[model samples]
Target chain A: MADKVLMKGNEAIAEAAILAGCRHYFGYPITPQTEIAAYMAKRMPKIGGTFLQAESEVAAINMVYGVAGAGYRVITSSSSPGISLKSEGLSYMAGSDLPAVVVNVQGGGPGLGGIQPSQSDYFQATKGGGHGDYKMIVLAPASVQEMADLTIEGFDLADKYRMTTMILADGTMGQMMEPVELKADAVKTYEKPWAVTGTKMARKHNIINSLSLVPEELEQLNFARYERYKQIEETEARWEEFMMEDAEYCIVAFGIAARVSKNAIVAARAKGIKVGLIRPITLWPFPKKVLCDAADKCKAFISVELSMGQMIEDVELATRCKKPVVLCNRAGGMIPTPEQVLAKIEEVAGGIN
Target chain B: MEPKRVSLFAGHYGSGKTNIAVNYAFLLKKMGKEVTVADLDIVNPYFRTKDSEKELSEAGIPLISSAFANSNVDLPALPQELYSLVERQDRYAVLDIGGDDRGALALGRYVPFILEENNYEMFFVVNFYRPLTTTAEEAMEVMHEIEDACKMRFTAIINNSNIGNDTTARDVLATFEETEKLSRLSGLPVRMTTVTAQVAEDMKDVENILPMVLQEKYFDINI
Candidate 1:
């Protein structure tokens, strides 16, 4: 009661990262998530951590690469356009198997998008982020609590898998304030034997590089990386189901859309629509099995999103198109209202016109 | 007649200052005062008095925020409309200054006018819920920084500590000692302690209580 303090989602992420033993932070300022860098700037120096506002997003991510290569927990954050600048470094980190965390507090995108909440970066985060056969462990947090919790989870997952874990939150999550209880004492540590820490005349020097020119070697590397990704897929897919026991229709959403969908689901239920929600906490290793199971029982599925039906494709694939998956969305920073989503739910339930 | 003509609310980031400022403006409006809420926030890129623009406009209160607010301009430029706050002495000005010194820097230019008027009550909205200003000393450190940046010492305190949307009357009551301690340390009076309307009914006896009309969050956002 006394210790739980109000924190913006961005501040929660920053404090959670520090609590999770992340000491080196490098980032360029971008809206909706700049509070993270600002917070890090204020707190990092006092705790003997390095907080560098790099010359560019590119330089910031490369600094992250350097720190992660040295076996230290490090992070960098940016919005949509800033993330586009870090893709090359992200691919390099993936190619080198360097474990670190990246955060994309997404805004409306396709160029210099509007500085408003949008989940348009779904495909960019979960699918085509960097130019390689790579996948970031993308965690979508709907509330400020999850924003903190998942940042800790992201660091642990990155270390465990030796890859990049991304906290994919919309502008609402980044900007909104909530009461968050941050656990500062309990930090999980990992053994990074392959880290490029100094050998000190004992062990062989670890070489951290991504440029493997050999055809067969590069092929094996890709295969091996995918193998690790497959393990992650089988074990790590996470989602939340609400009122799903006898639901006739299922709503699939994540981040802010998931929060909005909850309101719609409750309203639809009151109207005898029998709609439920499956909110994915993990976007990359998406909760496909839940969607598949919902497809069996549910008559229809609605994909609620802040983009032009990006997650709908995943829903269709996950459900094998067994039940009709309709897209209920708003693009370019506009989020769908609960009334709009409830209308879609009623539409799916049987013409409640 | 109870409060001064000019009311300034400034504090640490996420200290519930912006919400408090908006609610205070509405209070002045309810009192049949000519109210103008000037959002002098140049640091934080988050929620501002701009969130309540439509409601304020409908209520006939002129709202002013950063010139580039809610746009893709990405600059921390102040609006020229800020001068109206200083120029119009008849209107009751409720200011929502930015968080900490960086945000309060924008208030420096207007400090001369506020001091010249000598009828302003600058409030340091204290929130212990924020990470940086948990202790009274730490809170005072930030207050000093804000005082330095704005060039005007806060004349009063507004204990606005609360968890967004989850604040209980018990939580508001628990900070009584800290608020008193802050008031004692800074030699400033505790003007009011704010709580949401839901909790106000339960704790009506609490002194100097200002029941806030909170902006409903995104979940309960009015469509």
Candidate 2:
């Protein structure tokens, strides 16, 4: 076991990125997520890395695009509103197939909603917040440990697929502290053959841009990207099933909401109700197969979220309407209590058998 | 024997003071004392004693915090009811002070009343792993800074040296030597060395050890 240190989620993510050999960080300050930038600012200088507080999220994400195109590991983090400003740049990065890690420490939103934790950015994150029809490999971490682990994984996945990867966490997870063991120094694995490093006299020049004048060429590019997405969906869909073996009802949640639902499942189980939890660690791939498998055994499902039932749509789609799916949630920065979730589980279980 | 009535826990940021304070409150309450945890933290809005309102309340310990606590607002809205706790000589009170000199200034307002009314022990909690207080001299500097800001003196030093969740018995034992150095420099006795409860059972031979139940809201998903 490596040396474990108690770390806040945001700070842990930043340090993990550094440990993952991400030498360049560019980001704007936003609440609940400012710790990432602050940690980068303090440690990056000592470690001989570049940490720039960009003028805006737009400028910061564009800086990521530039660094990533040059074949360097780079990262940028923001809250909901700040992420909104970076969408265009994110789309540009995806269109150009540049590998970069973007962290969305989610907060309540439609506008500058609140600084408290919320899962309201589900649609914006997994469903392509940017303009193009591109999907980010969205990893939702429920703990401070996962915050560090997934950040390292996010960089690797980004480089593996040549696409932008996101660590979608909320304010609760960002502020919360837990013990985390950081990854030790390792050799770099993925090769960036398409990187726009300075063209030496021996090799052909590499062009990095999102522009293709011909519509046919752009259509072919989209099809190729979709093929990569298909591969990702097939292989990278990850989730955790708790007490799901003999469950009559299943609770679907992710991130902070999953933590609450786990408690609710325990409480429900104590009362002789066979409630289980399916926590999706990877939100983009949706973990549909596991949910479908649980749907076969469980008579009912409840989608517990910090948002107003955004992930429930995915749950319904995954189950194919085979079982009744209900929403047990708190929106606009409110978190559901274990008792509230337990009541929902009991209510759904009442209709099960 | 009667329990200690007024205990103040002060520390630097990320020093694990809040977790110690919460655990101490539970300890006192479990001993059948009338306990009240006053949230004197005006610096950090998140991870304060007020965030454990439900637990504290259910444990029969009243939590006295600012009105705007645990919210996005950063205003220091200290409640007038906190002064009444100072007047009550019957109950055991734990003052969970905020981080650093800036946070200690809030305690200055009640210094005269606390000094006049009751027997109090203001504990300066020190974590060796935290920045700025990595050494004994550096830890003494912070202790003096808090004393100057609060217009009161810390009676003793509490060695709360741990690197968050990664702390072990060895980590707690390693700080004992530095804390002795800190004791000599500050002319204050090392009251107790605190470690998480998980590590405490193995470190039984260590003197002046206070095992604290972890109160941090990591909220693990056991899946």
- Find the candidate with the highest lDDT and give its number: 1
Candidate 1 Cα lDDT to native: 0.88
Provide the DockQ value for model 2: 0.31
How would you encode candidate 2's per-residue C-alpha lDDT over A1-353 as one tens digit per residue?
A: 12566677888899889989998999998877877887788679989999999999999999999999999999999999999999999999999999999999888877888777899999898998899789999999998889988999898899999999999999988987766777755325587778888777868988899999999999999999999999999999999888988888999999999999888888899999998889999999889999988888889999999998899999999999899999999988789988899999888877667
Candidate 1 wrongly placed segments (more than 4 Å): A184-186, A351-353, B220-223
Residue lDDT tens for model 2, B1-223: 2446889999775677888888888988888888899988876647788778888999998999998887766476789988877888888899999877878999999999889875888889998765457689888878888889999999888888877656778877777888899998889988888887888888998887888866645354434
- Which 10 consecutive positions of candidate 1 chain B have the poorest summed lDDT? B214-223
True contacts kept of 2: 0.35
| Candidate 2 C-alpha error for residue B121, in Å | 7.9
Alpha carbon lDDT at B5, candidate 1 = 91
Tens digit of lDDT per residue, candidate 1, span A1-353? 37688988999999999999999999999998999999999999999999999999999999999999999999999999999999999999999999998999988888998788889988988896789799999999988888999999999999999999989998889988878888765568999999988999999989999999898999999999999999999999999888899988889999889889988888888888888889999998999998998899988889999998898999999999998999999988888998999988887777522
- lDDT per residue for candidate 1 within B1-223, as digits (tens), equals 3878999999998888888988898898989899999888877665777888988999998998887776666777898988998999999999998878998998888888889989989889988778888878889999999999888999998888787667788888888888889888999999998888888998888888898887656574311
Most accurate candidate by TM-score: 1
DockQ of each: 0.55, 0.31
lDDT for B86 in candidate 1 is 92
Roughly what TM-score does model 1 have, to 2 decimal places? 0.96
